[model samples]
Target: MTSRVLTCLLLSVLCALPALGARPVPAPAADGMAMLQRVDTARVQGSPSTLRTELDAQQAKAPKDPMPRVYRAFLALPSDESFAEFKALAVVYPENPWPHVGMGLVYVRWGMLKDAAAPLETARKAVPGFAPALWADGLRLQAEGKPAEAEARLREALTKLDIPRFRTDLALLLAGRPGAAAEARALLVRSVKDWPEQPEALQVLSRLAREAGDAKAGAEAGALLVALQPHDREAHRRQADAWLAAGDKAQAVKMLERYATLGGAEPAVLSTWVKLAVELDRPEDEAKALVRLAAATPKDPEPLLRLATLAEAKQDVAATEARLDQAAALAPERADIQVRRARLLLKLERYFESMAAYRAALAAPERPVPEAAEEAAQLTRKLHLPASPAKGTVEQIYDRVSLGLVALYLEHLMEKPELKGNLKVRVDLDPTGKATNVVVLYDSLQDVLITHSAHVAFMDAQYPPGSEPQVYQYVFRPPPR
Candidate 1:
């Protein structure tokens, strides 16, 4: 079956609240009230198992009350047990439409549509205008693949029922038919507005909105569904799908994060979450998912490897190295691991150690990285302190000039602990290492002293003799620890 059909089936199971009557059936006594309260509470907590014992106790206490028996038939869960109770109640209370209504619902829920007919008809005959009987018959027709007939019954039920469940079920039925989207959407919009706390209604509405390409409507329904189903991992994941379909990637990530946090760490979901977080530039969310992925796949090195990249972005050298060490330990022969270690070591200026890592990467049984050889040779020259590349060449010229920029930043910007900002200087270096044009592309600092120092620091600074204008951007924060 398709996932959408499966989700609809699951939803239908919960929407089995039998429409009893037009008016509320008052409990005969206080204990009956307590039983109803507990049942409602248990349903809210998603703990139906708790209902059986409590209902049994209530049934035993009030053998005369038909309401407990009505609830039992609904919550009993065991198809046979629920059927027997509802059947017995139907006979015991032949005059009451509720028992017959409950029996019909039990039969419909258990897929015994054939057997549901007699009790549903009996209930309608007993109470001439009871909406629950019509709704029950609608479910039977729906199960029997008679959607047109089912919709008719449900619509009739709605004339008397006017409840969220009736409207949502009718909407579900209509949504499955082609060209019925507008009518279905209208019903759901009204359903949610009238019954704001009904998650099932909102869930259906959200999916309808998503299918219609109404992203704002979908997101609104998705947000409410998530709030309503905080403990439902699969519900959260499904909501994530709806949000994603609606083009709300950030909200989708939020729902996915909730799914993972609630123990829905399936590999596919985790992988998608990682990709979304990276696309959204949410490092913190990406890290959270990576940690969960690592826990889920203890022997895999990918999560830790990706985490090392995030650590490098934050400039946490120790943390980056620690992550790399862990990844390398897990997959020592993996060529990519060696390559990453080489890159980190080179960034930290440990040339000799980086050379070893790069060589190891090159020698791995896996094909060597394309740039490994050139990078290794470059490191060799750095270690030997070879003559600088000819002036006007770009060979490491940026690196050489960056040292001066860093020094200027430390003096003019870092000196003020309370001040923090960034500056971008597009330096046009003509031949002879003279800067002909120094344009301040951006300076958040607004400090002329720092701007002047940056321009002067690069001016007359020796570059490759004929280097083209190179734009260098720098951000100064409080001095690194």
Candidate 2:
């Protein structure tokens, strides 16, 4: 009574298994359940191919057991084959909810949001308190621009499960909210407390602590993370970032060097290292790191541009231009690369080529920040060239952004209650965009000033529709002059 789909899948597996060059062992007796568990354990430990071989060997002995196929699906991480195996297993083992949930995870991993929805929703209906599908649905909703709704779903997920890892994810998503970053900290704090050996939570705690400017806390968290997960890529990176945040470049570099040595450091990580190295004024280190990263990732123009930047910092125009050529060929569509090339062309007094490059960058589709757009506009006007503007603008309604905000200043904050006066803000509206100074700025009119976070809101501020220089002034006055 096997369904046509199930029969077809088995036949496909039969055909493929033969090409795999392994003689099938007859399916084992029910007592062979231990062997199936062995396959599951191996897959969990990150050896899928070994599990596949085990499955091939076992299939000859126990062709009736669908567990090996389910095990295979588990190890196929981030692929559609997992769903195929799950579906086949579902037909053979109709009562199992695990396969359905496994199918949902495959859709989540592959970013097939719409397809993932039905299967996950079905699984949620079947298993009312399943955290995995709930977490997947939460993330999917977040990506679809429904953060508030995502948060509700994530909270529902929280009610269903008391898992540290899923809670950490939910907390991180919450941190994007106005005051909910504290919840993220609390979640990590609780996670580390309960699962002290959990590397990810410890690493996240390190990042959170450093961001909060608590060096002592960050150091403790990082040390714990490194101890628990010595060779983990994220652990090393977080340690490096923690050191940098704590103002210890030497230590940061040591950790970063180790990170770069680790396999699979993403390109963005390398880019951040290059930027920091450049700012630290270590040309040699920057160049070395650039070369290492350039060799590590695929031939992306970003690394080449970083190399050119490092060379430029060393005042080697010839070498810089050579690096620029490498970048230009690979990233013909990257506006930032084109912008960098245009600036280099300008330095070379190659006005025409520089203008062309700048124009090409200007025409590109990436949304430049208000400040960058403003800067680009200025450069174009200065050079008497026509300039194109970015297509979008966001409107903000705060009186002004400021620093040293007390309860009085809280009113000027995003969605905060009442403010007593006109808040003057020190904002630099340049071509990259408006950056409100977060440093302490005293205001005489009110007993206290607005919080530095207000300035952060402003510095991260994007203006609406105009290339005008952003100017902010917060004046705190008494009720009457």
Q: What's the CA error at residue 464 for candidate 1, in Å?
A: 50
Best by TM-score: 1
Question: TM-score for each prediction?
Answer: 0.59, 0.41
Cα error of candidate 1 at position 379, Å? 7.6
What digit string (tens of lDDT, one per residue) describes model 2 on residues 1-481? 2365466567545543333333433222222223433544454345657768876776667665555555566667455456666766555454444566567667677777787687777756655656656767888888778898888887887776665656767777866677776788888887667556555566667777777879868977897777666567776887877777777776677677778877636777777777777778887878778887887775666667777876887799999988887886776666777777777876775544565666667776663323445545554444332122212342232432222233334444434334345545454555555443434344434432233334434544565533454445556532432
User: Candidate 2 — number of clashing residue pairs?
Assistant: 29
Q: Residue 339 lDDT in model 1?
A: 85
The segments of candidate 2 whose C-alpha lies over 4 angstroms from its true place after superposition are 1-68, 192-204, 220-241, 244-481
The residue-level lDDT of candidate 1 at 50 comes to 73
The predictions' CA RMSDs to the true structure, in order, are 17.0, 27.4
Q: Per-residue alpha-carbon lDDT of model 1 for 203-230, expressed as tens digits? A: 7788788788887798788788777679
Error of 2 at 428 (Å): 72
